[model samples]
Target chain A: MRDSLVAAAFELFLERGYEQTTVDDIVRTAGVGRRSFFRYFPSKEDVVFPDHEQSLADMTEFLAASADSDDPLVRVCEATRLVMRMYAANPTFSVQRYRLTREVTGLRTYELSVVWRYEKTLGDYLRTRYADRRDGTLRANVVAAAVVAAHNHTLRHWLRSGGEGDPLAEVDRALGFVRETLSPDAVPAGGGTAGEQEAEDVVVVITKRSTPMWRVVREVEASLGED
Target chain B: MRDSLVAAAFELFLERGYEQTTVDDIVRTAGVGRRSFFRYFPSKEDVVFPDHEQSLADMTEFLAASADSDDPLVRVCEATRLVMRMYAANPTFSVQRYRLTREVTGLRTYELSVVWRYEKTLGDYLRTRYADRRDGTLRANVVAAAVVAAHNHTLRHWLRSGGEGDPLAEVDRALGFVRETLSPDAVPAGGGTAGEQEAEDVVVVITKRSTPMWRVVREVEASLGED
Candidate 1:
């Protein structure tokens, strides 16, 4: 019944336009009573983001279950994948909703609120994991935002491509860039035990801007072998 | 006149609560006509975020003026500082709004929408700068989101402290971390000319996870001296 209502509402929205289409019109088109429509969705905006609440819950649960991981960032990335998959599960519905939301200012604002919730959830999970670290709260918020941004970047690309490509692969690649960039070891601070050791042996050799690559490589190899 | 209306609105909102406070009550409190109130603010919610629109405009102008810089990210960070200064300029008012928004879900959502516009502005600037680069769009979006997240993290910390202390310093530090972490050099891709030279000359040394840092450092010095 809920699916039928969503389908009917989408048809009405596309045909009659979002602002012009009323709940009465949607209920009439869906062949469902007003009470059923009210039970399923709170308002017209709610219908446009039908699966967001459920997806958010699933993401929270997924993160909660991975509380023991060594790297919370990895878990956050995985949780984001769950969201991507939810959209991928029904590309047609997702694409239609995306177009409608893009065209409506209110719906776009609503979508931002939904996206904020996801970022907040991811940040909350990371906060717990990095509670003892300095600037943990800030780190959690920044990393969560980066993950969401990367996911959205890939998701939008797929949507613009009519949802035909492998969005999961694109998202994974984007997430990989984020992880490599913002991971604890990548940024400067108290280099962990391993990081400190790596830092000690790694001689950061800076060459002239116009230095040739072959000479630099040969110089590095010779330096390493000299010991 | 606008400031007086905002002050009146805030007073009425505190007394009657956000949801219960009507536009009529605000006009009455300000001793202003309904037309004047409407001219200043479109809705009750707009009063809570009076400076955001102007702040966003300033940021856009700042970025637009720096379109030809070698590193657009530097300009983006500077633009964000303008927003920080705006809030810092009126600490008491900012703190009060922060508290009220925290207590009201609708205002909080509205605030998120405002923040999204800032992020979008930064992303739009970055997208143009990185247009010809690989994964440029994705990189632009992720970096912009990271910047906004970092700024918000610091801003919230200051607000939670009742708008006391040095928020600009804290924000600069946070932005510095982001600039270092997500900067073009931090992420992987085609190494620029100088980067390629540095990359070639830099022979990464990996000591065992448990290796003592002093020993690793001594070995590195010895190797360099041997050459």
Candidate 2:
């Protein structure tokens, strides 16, 4: 019934425009009681992005489950995945919701505002994890900010592209970037633990700004021969 | 005139309350006409976050000037510093503003929405830098997010502690973590080269989880001894 109401509302929004649509019009069009519309969605805009409260609750649950992990980077990654999975499972709805959000200024603000809830929740968890470290507070805040940033980046790309491909890979790679960025010590297992070695030891050799991949590889190989 | 309006607004907000204070009261206290108040500030809440628009403009200008640099990471770090400098130059005002933002829910949301503008601006510049590289968009977004995250983390810590210490050092360290995380291969001159040596000639040793620092040092010394 609620889904139908939301579907009806979006249909009306497409047909008549968001400005012309109202709660009464939505309920009337859906053939549902006014109380039912209010019960399911608090306002007309709420119907457009109804899953926020639920997804936030879902994110809260995932973070709570992972709360005991001391691995701040891993914990943040897991919390971030919760959001990605929600979109992956419902790509069509998410895509439509994305379109609506991008077009509506109020909806866009509301969407961005929802991100803060995740940041705060993650930040709180981070504060607990880093309480003993000298820079625990700052680390937690950074970690939280990075998680939200990484998640939003992936989510936005997937959204902007019309949800066409495997976003999980992009999401993992992005999170991998954040994880490595925050905790370089955890570089992939095969990368050999020069994790302790000063990161400065690794020098990147690129041919020129326009260097081709094969040439870049040959240059790297040639450079390696010198040592 | 704008400065006086802001100062007067803050003084009044502190003495009375945000809701209780009116435009009439603010202008009367600041010795400005009602028309002058409208000319300077759009609303009472607008006066609370005066530097937001200007700071965003300054950051955009800094990034625009850095577009010629091939190093995207350097451009982002410099941009982050510009933002921090804006805050550092106004510690007292920022501290007071922080207090007001915390107490007012509407101001908090407004402040957050404005901060997103900074994040989006930085993220967009990063996107342009990484436009050609496959899988680069996600990496760029994450890097941008991490940069902002690092800045916000440092800023929040300074604000939360009542602006007690030099936040620039903290911001630098946080951003350093971000740079290292995102582009470990691009380490400075002292960091090792990115070239890979012949597998047979380079016997790299990784430290065990339980290995002591002294033992790891001895192992490195022994390996060099063989060479």
Candidate 3:
């Protein structure tokens, strides 16, 4: 019944325009009672984003259930991938909604609010993980925003391409950039091993050009020795 | 006239609640004609965010007038400070709007739209600067979001403290983290002189932990010799 209602609503939205399509119109087209349509969706706009609430809940659960990895940013990035998967699950429907959303200012605004909720979810989770760190709130907010921005960038590109190609691969590459660029561990600090060692270790050193090459070399050697 | 209208609207909004307040009541309270009220504000919600449009324009102009610094991200960060300045320019009103926005869902949603506009402005500027880069759009979006998130985090903290502390200083610290963490040049890449030589040149190198300390030393020595 819910699926039929969504189908009926999308058809009417496409045929008669979003503003012109009413609840009565959708129920009549679906051959369902008005109460049934209301049961499935509270309003016309709600039908446009049928899967968002479920997706958001799924994302929240995914983040909550994640292992306490040393790099919380990685967990946040993985959580966002779940959202991408939700869109990728129904490319045609997602594409249609994306196009429709562009035409309706209210839907666009609604979409932004939904995106903000996702960001808040991610930020709230990170805040708990980083509660002990100085500037944790700031870090959580920035990382959350970066993850969502990167995801939207890739998602919009995929949508614009008519949902062609591999969205997951594209999103992974974009998320990789965020992880590399904004990971807490990526910052320069004294070397300390906290998490399980990866196959490779990376050390980043920043120095002035005017400094002697020998001195820079010595600092690297010293840092590597500490590791 | 505009100030009086806004003042009247806010007073009524606070006393009678946002939903209960009407345009007619606002005009009556301000002792102004309905035409004057309409000329100043499109709706009751517009009165809550009186400075946003002007602040957005000011920010756009600030970005446009920025010197073509080699690191465009720095210029973008600087442009965001102009927004911080706008809020700091009037603390009492900013705090009142903040409180009212928190209480009203519509105003909160409207505020999110305003933030999106600001982010779009920043992202559009960055897209042009990074037009040739491989991940220009992704970088632009991520960096723009990061700047806004960091700014909001600090601004919210200031607001939650009842507008009591130094917001600009807090914002600077937050933006500094963003700049240090996400700047394009912050990544480890081969050194090359591009912009005006600063007082000091910085070199960053990343290498596998398994690499022999001696080998790591040699690579740095070798790279320094080329310069």
lDDT of candidates 1 onward, in order: 0.79, 0.71, 0.82
lDDT of 2 by residue, A80-120 (tens): 78778888888888898888777877787777678888888
Q: Which candidate is the best by DockQ?
A: 3
Cα misplacement distance, residue A10 of candidate 1 (Å): 1.2
Q: Chain A TM-score per candidate?
A: 0.84, 0.77, 0.88
Candidate 2 local lDDT, B75-189, one digit each (tens): 8888888888888988988898898888988788787788888888888888888787655666566667668877888898899898888888878887766654455333221
State which docking tier applies to candidate 2.
acceptable
Query: What are the per-residue Cα lDDT tens digits for candidate 3 across B1-227?
Result: 99999999989988989899999999999998999988878877898998889989988997888666657777877888888888898898889889999999999999999999999999999999989876888889999999999999999999888888888898888888887667575442222222111212345455665667676666555545456
Per-residue lDDT, model 1, residue B59, is 90
Give lDDT for model 2. Answer: 0.71
Alpha-carbon shift of residue B123 in model 1 (angstroms): 0.9
Residue-wise lDDT of candidate 1 within A13-67, one digit each (tens)?
Answer: 9898999999999999999899999899998899888899999999988887884
Candidate number with greatest TM-score? 3
Which prediction has more favorable lDDT, 1 or 2?
A: 1
TM-score for each of the candidates: 0.84, 0.76, 0.89
Order of candidate numbers by TM-score, starting with the best: 3, 1, 2
Task: Mark the regions of model 3 whose C-alpha exceeds 4 Å error after superposition.
Answer: A189-203, A207-215, A222-227, B188-203, B207-227
- The DockQ-based order of candidates, best leading, equals 3, 1, 2
- Restricted to chain B, the TM-score per model reads 0.83, 0.80, 0.85
